[model samples]
Target: MRSSPRLFQYACRITLFTRQNCSLCVNAKQVLSTVWDKHPFVYKEIDVMTPDAKGWQDLYEFDVPVIHIAKTEHGLERPELSAKAQKLMHRFSAEQVMEKMDIISDPKS
Candidate 1:
């Protein structure tokens, strides 16, 4: 039987805000690719340079690969993915990084 994604161990949504031909953004995407391949999560790339994306300019103008996570009302006491991933892998063999990605992509929030 197929299980609901919401019931998974952990789920993270990684969103990358970048511009065209930005070297740092390229590197960040590469890193995220590796991370995705190693985990069970979803990722999205956004070009804030686009006119329609101006709304995000104020918060992440300089931070191209800004990451955010969803919380369980507690507001994510500590939203450090790398550290949390490491700890999880140490305890379980599955060690799915994607399952732990608690990111938000919509700039409206």
Candidate 2:
């Protein structure tokens, strides 16, 4: 799991579930990189193909390039995040991610 140290635990955490040699995963990664550079959130990339990543692989075996945006200021995920923490599947765009990020940063949204 790779991340940016600058982003504290309280910040929004973006988790990207991906695998090797997948065109969609590569494309997702590129888009995520663009979003990350623009927003500078706590980003993490997990390769589902890894031996220890079996958990994620099991859930997303057929669905690669899954993204989860979690906002946990206390390091505890709130299931009530209607928009704060959202899962993005398949192909997505930076604009879509930015929208989600906006909601995460603004609780009133």
* lDDT per model vs. reference: 0.48, 0.75
TM-score (all chains, Cα) for each model: 0.55, 0.74
Count clashing residue pairs in model 1: 9
Task: Give candidate 1 regions above 4 Å deviation.
Answer: 1-9, 71-109
Q: Candidate 1 clashing pairs?
A: 10-99, 11-99, 11-101, 12-101, 12-102, 13-103, 40-98, 41-98, 69-102
Model 2 poorest 10 in a row by lDDT: 74-83
The candidate that wins on TM-score is 2
Q: Model 1 compared with the native: what TM-score?
A: 0.55
TM-score of 2: 0.74
lDDT of 2 by residue, 21-75 (tens): 8899889889988987888777778887899777677777789888888764536
Deviation of model 1 at 56, angstroms: 0.8
Of the candidates shown, which would achieve the greatest lDDT relative to the real structure? 2
How close to the true structure is residue 95 of candidate 2, measured as C-alpha lDDT? 97
